[model samples]
Target: MTFSLRRMLYEDRYKLILAACQDIRRHREEVAKTVIASQLLDALDVDVPSDALLSHIVAESLLRRIDRNLLSGRNLYLQVEKRPQIDLFTLLQRAIPAVPQGYALANQYLVHAMRQSSTPTLLEIGIGKGLQVVALLRALARDPGKIERIRVIALDPNRTALTEGVAAIDEVRAELPFDIEIYPLVKLIEVCEDADYAHFEALAEGSLSINAAYTLHHTTGPDSDARTRLLRRLRALKPRVFTLVEPSSDHDTEHLTRRMHHCWQHFATVFDLVDRSDASPDEKFAIKEGFFGREVRDILGTSDAFRCERHETLESWLLRLKKSGFVPYPEIELDVDLPEYCRSSVSSGLVRLSYRSVPIIAVFAFAGEAG
Candidate 1:
């Protein structure tokens, strides 16, 4: 056979092997285990079985490999190259009716923030897949003549994420009645960087308003100098308003406890609802053990890096803004209603879950000559 023919034959053989494996009784479970195991290996820079393995023994072995890889302390993203494309906006929209109370809280908070200025140029940090941006744009579409043109600059370090987000924004815009424009800023520009300051200043120099959301936590860590630097940079830009919405879990000594509780409560609920019971025992164990049990604990343990003092409480964040020479507005609270899968996990003891008896704070701060 010619080289091209041989290559085609090999490709066909691999596909046939995969198809054969799929015919097994526990095919779904097996596939899940293989995918997870392969991901773990990929993260570890270790070679794994690329050829199809049909035996249960092979599947069990792969699961063991995944457990070992996890024990080695690898990043989850490294292990799993492809994450499920979640339609976050659609999910949020569907969840609104079921959790109207929670939706009302978020809507009210967002409305109050928007009302702070007539033409706020919304800036979103960590614009993952552009879902939140799309939602914000949709909301803005309700009153196209609110005041003036809106500019959105989405910043992220990952080029792939930014590209995907931009594409998603374009896809969403095609379906919408409004013609809002979105700009993609791909540099991992820190709030503290001089270049960042210049870039932002140029964007906001003529714009009527400025705002940011859900992007502050990325700048936090044990390095107080870095944190201070970031704060100073943000203060310099002096955006008309800034809003931060983060996970409300405390990050002190109880970090692990909070994370475990959140994972068990939130993720476990999601798994029960979305995952199939017929999935391989290995796959089920992973969701229970690998993600909720291991991953959450690992992340919480690194609270110093992940925790934000400003995010700990809205009052504290508001106070910081005041101290920095910005007027603090009345803080609002927004609750993201958990999905049905997550709701199930909460009901079960799989995850520790709690709803703030009082309202959870989601504050906004205003700068410049506030109208």
Candidate 2:
């Protein structure tokens, strides 16, 4: 009897999703389609649907609203751990135009902060493959005389990524005119103790700048107070500047349906950009499936404790920053030219990267003061 009831619930969800897909197709207006999509996703979240049905909803219905090729052969349960490749990360960074643009904006802010001192120390959280650091090094190299030497403290949980990132920075250091030193730590920021932070603070010697790009969202959990406490600790550092780069979406909710809706909206723009990129079809598949598909799976398919991609909105981030004793830094402009598909806007303490009016990524710089 229990098995029969479970089967009935699954079948009902599958049928409801199918009907929602049809309704979405009939609706010509984007707002109407979005409403239907959100409602449908919310209802389906009550009882989890099958992987195949979820894939169909995404490939056939959700992505249709984005004006892109239908995602094919996608599984909701696809495991990202089995396929950890730096190549995929590289492809994602290159294929998405907003990515490099975000990196450039972040580098611009970091370089500006570095200029305040002759020997500045940078402790980058989630220093994945050191892509942003490498870019920052190149930017600093262009005007070498302003700074004498630079020290980079690279931190991330992935040992392989830490190894690759340090090596990349070292290679760039060889070409740059200034002396560069790298201290790579294989640990998550959430787990760092007072001693670890003391070591970090001592290394900076008062000239500290912090950068956490697309990786701080993972530090959001283990508990509710986690992000708050982490931010407080960062405030305690009293760094010269703290730069954060994150996707501007609200998937950090207990409501699975709302989470799914936000996830769909956010990744739709990302996947659409991937489709439009100059990358080959196979490369596109790899990115959408191997890179982003995993993130989608984690957001919708996993429990909150297990979900690492708990992205929040720009508003939530600002509130947290304020509560943690950080105000928006004065310079909030991206003087560098951006891609045609991407446009930037400055708010109180945030710089948003949007795709056709949808907020995609946000770069926030903060000083130790509540505004």
Q: List the residue pairs that clash in candidate 2.
A: none
Show the lowest summed lDDT stretch of 10 residues, model 1: 344-353
**Taking the candidates one at a time, how many backbone clashes does each contain?**
8, 0
lDDT of each: 0.42, 0.71
RMSD of candidate 2 to the true fold? 10.0
Instruction: Please write out the lDDT profile of model 2 over residues 125-179, one tens digit for every residue.
Output: 9888887899899988886547888999999899998998998898876778888
Native-to-model Cα distance after best TM-score fit, residue 47 in candidate 1, in Å: 32
Candidate 2 regions with alpha-carbon error over 4 angstroms:
1-54, 57-85, 369-371
Residue 12 in model 1: shift from native, Å? 55
The estimated TM-scores of all candidates read 0.52, 0.78
Instruction: Please provide, for model 1 over 154-267, each residue's C-alpha lDDT reduced to its tens digit, 9 standing for 90 to 100.
Output: 777678878877887777665554445566787654633676667667766544234444455445545534544554556566655444443333222233323323322333
Local lDDT at 348 for model 1: 10
